[model samples]
Target chain A: MIELTDVHKAFGSKRVLRGVNLTIPTGTSMVIIGGSGTGKSVTLKCILGLVTPDRGKITLDGQDVTKGDRDAFLARFGMLFQGAALFDSLSVWQNVAFRLQRGAARRPKAEAREIAIEKLRRVGLTPEVADLFPAELSGGMQKRVGLARAIAADPEIIFFDEPTTGLDPIMAGVINELIREIVTEMGATAMTITHDMTSVRAIADNVAMLHDGQIKWTGPVAEMDDSSDPYLDQFIHGRAEGPIAAVR
Target chain B: MSGATLALAPVAAIGRLAIFAVRGVSHVFRPPYYPREFGQALMQIGWYSLPVVALTALFTGGALALQIYAGGSRFNASSVVPSIVAIGMVRELGPVLGGLMVAARVASSIAAEIGTMKVTEQIDALVTLSTNPMKYLVAPRLLAAVIVVPALVAVGDSIGIWGGYLVGVYHLDFNAVDYLKNTVNYLESWDVVSGLIKGAVFGFIVALAGCYHGMQSGRGAQGVGRATKSAVQAAAVAILATDFLLTALFFTS
Candidate 1:
């Protein structure tokens, strides 16, 4: 389980996250939905220790994440970034098996490549694609490659940031289904941030709506449509005018 | 901005760069060295830069010989061309010009590549993969620059003196044997050593400036362009400034 309490963060005079408190139970898929620039990424980065909160307590499995061995802490989590974030200099398989190539998780090169190929296959890519660079792949293929890399380590936790942002609707659905299946099969605690309603319906077990740097509404997916919160309703229905202003 | 803020800005920037340099240098001695990356950097910074350094030194040396011959002729001392050319090439021009050439080529390339990586969030991805950017990216380049640059300067110095020899012996109708003898007799071991030391320092400046601006680059294409520009400018300035200081330290009475 991952828990964040009273997390507050600011950049210069602009306040981003203010008193954000949330918890994800073990083996659950929690999708955070929000408009652009609402601190969703910042919140996720804070948990990953990529960004430090001004004042907060983040505990992973009852251990304070900020005060432990970083490598050991990071070993338990995998993240798929918004832009895929694949290293252009490295081949696809090398990117997937990056973790296994160094440090405490170091493995033999051949074994790492084998595992990379397997993960690539799991994400609907062929073994032939492993030798290609990220730039050679199409946008959809790159997302699949990113997904393959995220699950390559079989991490206990996985983060998906805007997973289906730029994909066509069909490709988005395919990615959403893949994400849902991976989360269910691996039983890994998943935290995804996306505004795609289809993705939310397909992948989210629970939905949390973030507005104005705070969680405005959070409930199980089954109850999300029934929630009467005006902000949540306006956001989910894609209305321009609401209590939550369209422009910041 | 106020005058005080303007004055303090450079101080603050220097402080930040100092801190970044210390961090990068500290990682150089730490474990988990990436030999493959270091080898790649060596090739990029040293081997690939040879042609430019060689060409620049050749022209500078040839031009220096002609100018010195012209000036010395006014005093009926045209025989001093080979000796003056050799000393000038070994003592100053070799390291300074070689360093500036590298600053123009290698520094800008480093900044652009790393800045693009940062913009794409690959640096953050490296962190997530349990790799330190300082170790994997910055240290190898720093090591390569510091090690390979002096060798480049030595090559530049030799090529420069050879350029002068060509100009003096063939173009100016001087005896080849006499010109070579003058060059060999006038050049001192300290002159070469001092230039090599300056080469090492200039190399460090180039790599550090590139890596620093890259890591600090903001998002987008414009940010990368700015970073690349700033890195080359900073490196060129730093090399020239350090050259002056090193020259003062080495040659002043």
Candidate 2:
């Protein structure tokens, strides 16, 4: 489980996160939905320790992660970045096995490559695609490779940032299904940030809506459509009016 | 403007710069030394930069020979050409000029490459993988450049001295053996040592400036361009400053 209490973050005069509190229980997929720049990414970064909160208590599995051992803490989680952020210089397999080869696990090169190929197969990419660089692969393929890499070291937790952005609907669905299967198969606790309703429906076990630097609504995915909150209704229905302004 | 406001600007900028430098230095000693990356930086900084550094050194050596001949002729003693050229190339010209040339090449490449990685979010990806971007990306390049640049300076010294020898033996109508003998006689251990030391320091400056400016880069193409330019400028300035300081410390006449 991951917990954040009274997390606050500001960049200069702009308060991005305002005393946000949330809890993510073990073995659950919580998808946080929000408009861009509403501190969704900041929240994720704070948990990853990429960004520091002004005053907050963050704990992982009941251990205070606020000032916890960073490497030891990070070793437990894997991440799939928003842009798929693959290294241009590395071949697809090398990128996937980056952690295995250079990871704290300290596996040898040949072993790392074999595991990378295995994970790529898990993500529906063939061994031949492994030799090609990120620039040579299509967007969908790149995401699969990114996903393969995230699970390479078999981390206990995984964070997915916009897993379906910029993909065609069919491609998005395929990725969503793959994410769902992988989460369950690995039994890893997953947190994904996305605004895609289809992705949220396909992958989320629990849904959280971020608004005005706080979580406005959260519930089981099944109850999301029937929520009584006006903000949730306005957001999901894609309506512009009725207590939810397009801009604030 | 108020003195307080004016002072605050430099202070803030310095603070940011210091943070950047400290992070870069810490990365230099840490683990996950990327071998391929270190090899690539070596080729870029030391090998690929040879043509430009060689040309600069050659021209400077030939020019120095001409100047020495002119000065010696005034004293009715033009035999000092080879000896003067050898000393000048090894002690000052080889390391400093070669360093500046590499500053133009290595610093800009590192800055642009790392800056693009920053804009593209690859650095963040490294972080999520439990890898420190500073240690993974910056350390190997810095280490490789520092090791290889002294070898580069040694090569530059040989080439520069040859350039001077060509000028003195052919253009200045001096005997070839006399020129060679004078050059061989004038060469000293301290002169060669000084040049190698300068090379190591200059290499560090190049890598440091490159990584620093790259991390400080903002978003988009304009940010990359600015980072590249800053990398080169900072490297050149650091090289010249260190050259003067090292020269003073090593060989004060």
Candidate 3:
């Protein structure tokens, strides 16, 4: 389980996260949805230690993550970056096997390549795709490659950042289903952040809405539809006029 | 900016750079060294830079010989060409000019490439994959630059001597045997060794400046552009500063 207790983060004089609290239980999928520029990425980055929170306690599996052994703590978690941030120089298989061939999981190149191919297969990618560069793949295929890479080390926890963004509806559905299957099959705790409701419905066991630098609402996915929170309704239904003002 | 603020920029930048250098050095001894990444950086920083350094050295040596002969002609000391040209190339021009050229080419390239990756979040992806960004991205480049730049300076020195030999024998009507003997007799081990040492320091400066600016880059297109410009400018400035300090230390006695 991952827990954030009243997190606060500021950049210069501008505060981005303000006393935000969130919890994701073991073997469950939680999707945090919000409009653009609501500090969604900042929240995820704080958990990953990309950005240090000004004040908060982040605990992973009951251990204090902020003051814990970083390498060991990171070993148990996997993340899919927002842009499917694949290395252009490395081939797809190499990118997927990156974690499998590092630290405690260190293995021979051939073995790592095999594991990469297997994960790619699980994510609905062919063996030929493994030899291709990231620039050669379409946006959807890149997301699949990112997903394969995320699960390559069989991590106990996974964080997906905008997994379904910039994909067609059909491809988004495919990715969402793949994420759901991988989380369930591996019995891994998963946290995904996106504004896509279809992705929320397909992959989320619980839904949390991040707004005004804090989680405004959270409930079971089944209860997501009937929520009385205006923020939740306006965000889910994609209304322009709402309590959440457009940043632009 | 005020003159006081402008003057403080170098001091502040040096302080930050020192901190970054210390952090990177600490990371090197830590776990998860990526041999593959380092090998690639070696090829790019070291091997690929050779031809350009050689070309620069060749032309510089030739030019130095002609200028030396012309100036010596006024005093009927034209025979001074071979020895003076050889010493100048090895002691000053070879390493310093080669470093500046590489600072222009390699530093800008590295900063632009890495800054783009940073903006695109590829470095973050490496972290998420449980790979250290310092190990995967910076270490190899740093190691390769330090090791390769010295060898490049050595090769450039040899080519530069040959360029001077051609200019002396053909243009100045100097005997080949006498010119070669003068160059051989005037050359000192300390001179060559000092030049190579300077090369290594300059290479480190180039790679370090590139990696530091790249990692510190902000969002969007302008951030990347600034990183590239700063990397080249910093590398060039460091090379010249290090060259002056090394020269004073090496030749003061």
Candidate 3 or 1, higher lDDT: 1
Quote the positional error of residue B20 for candidate 1 in Å: 0.5
Q: Runs in model 1 with CA error above 4 Å?
A: B1-4
Each prediction's Cα lDDT score? 0.94, 0.89, 0.90
lDDT of 1 by residue, B83-110 (tens): 9998999889999999999999999999
Q: After superposition, how far is residue B62 of candidate 3 from its true place, in Å?
A: 0.5
Deviation (Å) of B207 in candidate 3: 0.7
**How many steric clashes does model 2 contain?**
0
Each candidate's fnat: 0.80, 0.80, 0.87
TM-score of the first chain of model 1? 0.99
Model 1 residue B51 lDDT? 100
Superposed Cα deviation of residue B19, candidate 3 (Å): 0.9
Q: List the residue pairs that clash in candidate 2.
A: none
Could you tell me the TM-score of chain A in candidate 3? 0.97
Instruction: Report the number of the highest-TM-score candidate.
Output: 1
Would you list the clashing residue pairs of candidate 3? Answer: none
Q: Rank the candidates by DockQ, best first.
A: 1, 3, 2
- Among all candidates shown, the one with the greatest DockQ: 1
What's the CA error at residue B252 for candidate 1, in Å? 1.4
Worst lDDT run of 10 residues, candidate 3 chain A, spans A239-248
